[model samples]
Target: MGLLKFIAVGAAIGYGINYITKKGPNGRSILDDITEDAPEWFNKAKTYATEKVEEVVQQARPNSGY
Candidate 1:
């Protein structure tokens, strides 16, 4: 019973992946859209983290020198 359930779930997931990867009326696959935007999000996160680390260093510098 457990094995059958697992196979059914796996098939459903595989079907979903196949469906999304097909181009819609817009002429672009769902995977293409997601991958296109990934880099922008990654760069934004990197910038935000750098700014935060700089702030922390600036705050600690004054205390240490005193």
Candidate 2:
């Protein structure tokens, strides 16, 4: 089955490409980034991370006392 072999090879290549793209720092995943906005949960998570970063920065500075 030449047809079956071709299908398998195509699938493997597609999966490999997807894996590399995700693992690499290529900014955005092809599927999710193109298909949808960054979800609300992600936005909320980013806000929390930013708050923590600011807190750490204030603590590190001299007499900032934030």
Candidate 3:
């Protein structure tokens, strides 16, 4: 009984999150908005941001070695 209740709660939360994040008006997934049609500037900005995050992660790592 307890296990069933826990499973029910987990399923409810999962469904709620999935429902809440479904996009609305002018909304689109990151991949959809950023793919083929997005401007070059946006793509460059994304690349720069990704590089910055990677650099920060590297700096935080111990030696960041293989």
Candidate 4:
């Protein structure tokens, strides 16, 4: 029953994404813009995570800097 529910949910989400991304006002598929910007978004997220990790490490180190 749990597996069936998961499958149903997944299918619904897939269908919704397909429907919404089929085309945009510009006639280009929404996925085209998403794919173009994915790299930039991923890089930003990576930078944010890296900065946070460095912050945590610095906090863990005593006398590291004040």
Candidate 5:
């Protein structure tokens, strides 16, 4: 039963992806827009993550008398 459920869930996800990515009369897909902007989105996420990590590290470090 669990295996069947897993397979059904996988099929549903696959169908959803296909539906979203299928181009309409305009010949453009959601996937196309996503691919085009993925790089910029990735860069923004990376910068945000780096800044968060730096903030956490700064908080973790013991401050010396300056």
Candidate 6:
């Protein structure tokens, strides 16, 4: 029973992967879309993180007479 369950789970995962990678009528798979857009998404996230870090650093610093 345990072996059968494992096989069934494996098969389900394989099918899901196939379904995602299969091209649609527009000729692009889910993976293709992700590959195309991932760079823009990553850059946006990185910029947001950098701004937050700078804000925190500024708040942490003590006032200087300068």
- What is the lDDT ranking, best to worst? 1, 6, 5, 4, 2, 3
Clashing pairs in 4: none
Q: Model 5, 1-66: lDDT tens per residue? A: 999999999999999999889998889998898899999999999999999998888788859522
Q: What is the TM-score of each predicted model, taking all chains together? A: 0.68, 0.38, 0.38, 0.66, 0.70, 0.76
lDDT of 2 by residue, 1-66 (tens): 999999999999999777756834767666566456558768889999999998889879969555
Against the true structure, candidate 4 reaches a TM-score of 0.66
Per residue, candidate 6 scores C-alpha lDDT tens digits across 1-66 of: 999999999999999999989999999999899999999999999999999998888788758522
Q: Which ten-residue region of model 6 has the weakest summed lDDT?
A: 57-66
lDDT of 1 by residue, 1-66 (tens): 999999999999999999889998989999999899999999999999999998888888966763
Which pairs, if any, clash in model 6? none
Candidate 1 stretches greater than 4 Å from native = 56-62
- Name the better of 1 and 6 by lDDT: 1
Score candidate 1 by lDDT: 0.94
Question: What lDDT would each prediction earn against the true structure?
Answer: 0.94, 0.78, 0.78, 0.90, 0.91, 0.93
Query: What count of clashes does model 3 give?
Result: 0
lDDT accuracy of residue 10 in candidate 5: 100
Q: Model 5 Cα displacement at 41 (Å)?
A: 0.9
Model 5 ranges with Cα > 4 A deviation:
1-7
- RMSD in order of candidates: 2.7, 11.3, 8.3, 3.3, 2.7, 2.4
lDDT of 2 at 38: 57
- Evaluated at residue 52, the lDDT of candidate 6 is 100
Please give the RMSD of candidate 4 to the true structure. Answer: 3.3
Question: Candidate 6 at residue 21, lDDT?
Answer: 99
Cα displacement (Å) at residue 20, model 5: 2.0
Q: In angstroms, give how far residue 48 of model 5 lies from its true place.
A: 0.4
